[model samples]
Target: MTLSQDISDIAIIGTGPAGLLAGYETNPSLNDSQVDIFTKSSKIGHPEHCSGLISFEGLQRLNVSMPDLKKKIGYNSIRYAKLIAPNNLSFRIDRGTKAMIVLDRPKLDGYFAAKTRKRGCNLHLKCKIHKIGYTKGYWFLLMTNQGKKSVTKSKFLINAEGIHTHLAKSLQLPVPNHKWHFPAFQAVIDGVKDLERDCSELYFGQEFAPGFFGWVIPLNEESARVGVAVGSWTGNNTRKYFYKFLKSHPRLKNRLRKDKIVKTYGGIVPGAGPISRTYHTNYMVIGDAAGQTKATTGGGVNIGGFCGRIAGKYSKKIISNEISSKQGCVDYQKQWRAFFEPNLSLMKFFRRTLSFLPDKDWNKIFQIASTTGLEKNMKVTDIDLHGTGLLNYAFQPKVITKGLKLTPHLLLSYLRGVLPD
Candidate 1:
């Protein structure tokens, strides 16, 4: 059918996990034309920018079945992590069981897109929605593909465009804060060495990844995704930083067979928690567009996709007149933020505070953490809601008493971070 032939009940942009899940949840009565999803990318998960690491609990919250996903998308299990400091001092956090999943992101997206289609949502890849408007009681969209323009209309809209917020801005919605955004780069490589199959490594220091850190997430014993993200304050040379890290880091360089680099990609990470507002009249935003990414780790699939599910379910209600547009917008905002926002806000506070410290300070912090057992206590036990875990460990009466006696200054910093507005 032509774009102008029928008016959809709901329109979604971008086919990332968020958009696809939104369409799936909408499930407009087996009528494929009632819900339309659009994206400029030719494929559902092409040019993957996300790390694709999510907690098992996160997947459950998004209504994803691991057994089903394993058979379809395939994934790597990560049960531990090695955190390296600037001075090469390091510590390990062992969860003793699979704590994270490294997904084949493209395949995950493809799986969801296919499922969404089966649920009666129309998927229009290579079709970019360039403009949108709300008139009277309907939403109008202008799009183009292969140099041909098309127009469509819907009762509501969902924007899941990731870091591209131009459309959100055009709609007069509040975008994520730019101050916390960072440029990130990564390379998939084989011939890796001296790395455990179930462990991910994080390297911290200013010499290589200034204002941020480098990571090696092993897909297996001989291959991994090596990447780095630098704060916006570090200037725009993430790729340069990445290459230098690959070549210079003492332990990391020795672990990777750099010559076998299979592919390189990069994207911007929005770490500024959620924007002030995620909804407006007849429309809502989810995924990276709404800044639903984890502040400490920049992973978005879990939270973003979860929020997209909420959007999808609510969009269906709004379209069917089960709820007024205004009430639907309010419900969507409250429902998503109620469960995820507090932890996300805490992580953002911790990250922003850590970003200001110098390399020497990081080394000192690591040293103190090791000696005082802080590292063991701060281990991230809950991947989906890790801030609560970290906070519980740090704020325990015994831990606080020890911190006050052993390192009053560091304790003050920790206190300030938690209480920051």
Candidate 2:
């Protein structure tokens, strides 16, 4: 390939699932004429970091929703979640059907990339965007790969780069508010003991994963993804903390045979809700770069996928002259915000309150949940995408009473932010 200093219609940076889908959604007229997608990595998805636990609804929304992998990558369709406390008090929420699935993320991304490529979008892998600037109605990007440097131009830029916001920040784009950065450490273990492939588990305690928590998502009857995340308020000692957690828990210690560990993954997740402004000039930011993640669980795939489509659609409108590019960017942000902000606010409220709690508070909370049948009231379809729905339980006297008993202060915090009475 040779360099051509031509103006591209749109340039999508990053080849994560969101970026790949964004390129795919770019109208045929716009993309076939002029669109380019770039990724710094040699492959679509690698050094995979997610637990790969996504809701059925989320998968459908992503257009990647499938019952299972084509290559039989192995997955456990989850129907239950066992929330465990420090003292080992646990409560199970069972949906009894396939509400979510644990998957191989790398393969999932590859599937989307293949589909996007079929749509005729130009993909540049192993290309890194080092800097970006705007002038004369075009965005100029300084890119490099294998000691080779080149500059590219685009009328519009869709930054779907996962959690890294360097491009946006360098371009002087607005960023999400910062209070805590959740860094995770994970281990893919096989030959586990006493673990159910269909039942995922969440462990909570400040010492284990301050601010966030730890999780176990089984991919099969014998293997699962296990990880822990700690908030930015704590230092960047995620690996140290994860090892401590693995050693401290009786169940984890026994189940994770020293020789059974298969792999490890590490990554950072931004939490505090999405940024206020995701559009600046001819720019539209989606995915983690826009912080379109659920604060409760710090996952972004579904929400990001949903918003990426909106961005792609409007980008086409801009190219077709149906709308101005600036307005298209504005509408893109507006569309995603209308549906996600309120839910994100709710999740953020709970996250902030929970982040401050000590280990003992979690024990008390779990104790209340066990006694109140809260677990029974929960539907298996509880998706992290809408944290606001969790508050619906307030309508139930038993649930509310039990919640209040566990932490009146947390309830008060909720009211102050959401109810204000």
Candidate 3:
């Protein structure tokens, strides 16, 4: 069990939930000193970009509790979402369960870091790995720490570096397509009118957020997080698109007051499903780096956290010599896929179908959904498993009959859209 100072059993790049969870999951198998989590940021959770809407079920599966999060850092409960079509038509989806909550994201990361550290994982903040190489079954990471350069070696590597896939690309892993990566922007603002504390709203339109959508996630009665994500192919500035959405959207503009900004955050979101390969002989990729995000919602925390836990559990096997590193990596890949691929793949298909539909088609679809009780039948049992819920709703005899009756063209368009997938 003895080792050199510069060497570790595992080196995790990035201190996000994925990396922290990966470290935490190692547990009794690997001592804390054997795992090192490196981050470019100086703190555990800084520069938060997520809207922080996550399912209590998902968080529970990851061993995170609402009470723990609330007692440490506050969060808000949400049970409904309003989906607005391009033509201003909308429908309300009631999630009839105690499943969703809005997290104080920065603190959430801090919580994960605290847990990981308590489990004996080493956290090396402000240490950015600039270059990485594999040689003789060990990964060498060239890093800069507080302006000084050094190298560290590890038997295994976990990439949790979020959306910038530079490290994954360097390892020759197929990164998510650039076209499907949307630039997203959001702001915390006060003085909001008619804020629904328990409801979040999604606005869909090309003029505002092409190939994606805008969202209003209410934090409280007086303030909310408003944001927009736009596709790269639109040739539009995401900030400009956000400004336009803030100032001109028919329903949203009326709800905001001028100069009421509290804070703003922006980042690129991956809409593609999980990458083609997430593992190799001595390394694995998790989190946004591996595109472990929901294409439908651009949410990665829960999905990536699941994958990270798999990687963490597999790490114990690899480190304890219970399994070869290569087999462990392969198993990690297979396990995560088994846990989330069906839903992620289905969500990707839905995203593609929605992207192909025109605004007029959206209007008709909304009309049909309203008239045929499609929205009413959408009893989403779990927010993270939306694909399954949607499938259950789509196959209803009444929904099928009404779709064929009212919007056969829309149905045909959907069939055509399936061909591309």
User: What's the lDDT for all of these models?
Assistant: 0.82, 0.79, 0.83
What tens-digit string does per-residue lDDT give for candidate 3 at 130-178?
Answer: 8888999899888888888888999889989888888888877877766
| Model 1 score (lDDT) | 0.82
Q: List candidate 1 stretches off by more than 4 Å.
A: 1-3, 30-33, 372-380, 397-421
lDDT of 2 by residue, 155-207 (tens): 88899987778888876777665554588999988888888988999998887
Please list the residue runs of candidate 2 whose C-alpha ends up more than 4 Å from where it truly belongs after superposition. 1-3, 29-31, 65-74, 380-382, 403-421
For every candidate in turn, the CA RMSD to the true structure comes to 3.2, 3.4, 3.1
- TM-score of the candidate numbered 1? 0.92
Over 4 Å off in model 3, which ranges? 1-4, 28-33, 401-421
Backbone clashes, candidate 1? 0
TM-score of each: 0.92, 0.92, 0.93
For candidate 3, the 10 contiguous residues with the lowest summed lDDT are 412-421
Error of 1 at 14 (Å): 1.2
Q: For model 2, give the 10-residue run with minimal summed lDDT.
A: 412-421
Error of 1 at 94 (Å): 1.6
Cα displacement (Å) at residue 265, model 1: 0.9
Q: Please give, for residues 244-299, the per-residue lDDT of candidate 1 as tens digits.
A: 88888888777776689999999887777788788988899999999888888788
